[model samples]
Target: MSLIKLSNIHKRYGKGTNVFEALKGVSLDIEAGEFVALMGPSGSGKSTIANILGCLDSPSSGVYDFCGVNVSELNIKQKALLRRHYIGFIFQGFNLLPRTTALENVELPLLYRQVPKKERLRISMEALELVGLDKWCNHSSNELSGGQQQRVAIARAIASKPLFLLADEPTGNLDTKRSVEIMEILQNLNKDSKITILMVTHESDMAKYASREIVFLDGKKKSDTKEDS
Candidate 1:
């Protein structure tokens, strides 16, 4: 099934003399359980397209269908609710609370869902375990290394059991070896758990980790290629 569909997406900033088109009639269809990477140079609109897919922003003019519903039609509150329930986000900066323990950070999303404290703790622990960081569950964000901190961030993102995972420069801060490890974890999730993943990256090596690659340039898709399994 097509989990995400974008048609004739056009996003403009400002108007008149200062007008700029960040996305110009870009169209895409992402299937459920597919691991796709958006590859582009800086200012190529990969991040803009990622934000649109994540419901972080609405296109100026377009149809964005997510899981068969028109996401642009949703109100702010509805979009927030849907994001919490169905989307998981991982970013370049590893956005974890500095003072919070890894487990607590992972449980933060469950708190918003009003999950029971005990069950939330259980799921958070499981998520940490999935990322091979359960032993550091009590460590604060600063106490962990760059790779470990990113693992905790991944744990937290998956705690909600989201169907789609959106990552922007997920390996940006890690070394090559650590980046490979993180990519392995993501590949495992897509292979074993069937979680759909959409990631934006400038590195071709990183994009190779995905099952498919889509190149973007000048606010439009340049090509889409499916890798052989």
Candidate 2:
């Protein structure tokens, strides 16, 4: 089964005369270990699809399947559980806690999961090492550079070993060099660890790092293409 399947999905906001349709009959499937990029300008429905895939919002109509389960039909609590257990989210902003060590910040999610301290430490450390941030684990967010801070954010996202990573404009706030570095880390994670990744970005340059590109325009999929492996 596909890791994620969206069949004719739609999303509308507001009501009646003020209704704004964000996604119109959108359909897509992401198999396991695929690195897919969702790209478009603002209001093009790329972020709308990402929000739906991340379980942050429900589709107005149609179905969403993840790992063969119907996510559109799940309750709020169930959706929250799905996000907590299966999705690792990375945003443009480095959401790391200020004044906290990188290791501690990475362990925050596991704390919410009630994992034992020992195991949490181990997993967080492994995630940091994956991003080549092990040596900086003791540094505070303020002590790190923009790229280092973003690396910590990625480590935090992967600490739980989530089924997939959802990255929303992850390189938006960095310089060109740092942006490429971050993309390389994501590409490596997808290539080496077989981590499924769905990223949303308007930057064509960053999107190239993903194996597949899915472009959106006017709430519809404009193109879906895969590069040679």
Error of 2 at 20 (Å): 0.9
- Report the alpha-carbon TM-score of model 2 versus the true structure: 0.98
lDDT minimum window of 10 residues, candidate 2: 155-164
| Alpha carbon lDDT at 48, candidate 1 | 93
Query: Model 1, range 108-186, lDDT digits (tens) per residue?
Result: 9999999999999999999999999999999999999999989998999999999999999999999999999999999
lDDT by residue (tens digit), candidate 2, 99-150:
9999999999999999999999999999999989999999999999999999
* lDDT score, candidate 1, position 86: 98
Candidate 1 pairs with clashing backbones: none
Q: After superposition, how far is residue 129 of candidate 2 from its true place, in Å?
A: 1.0
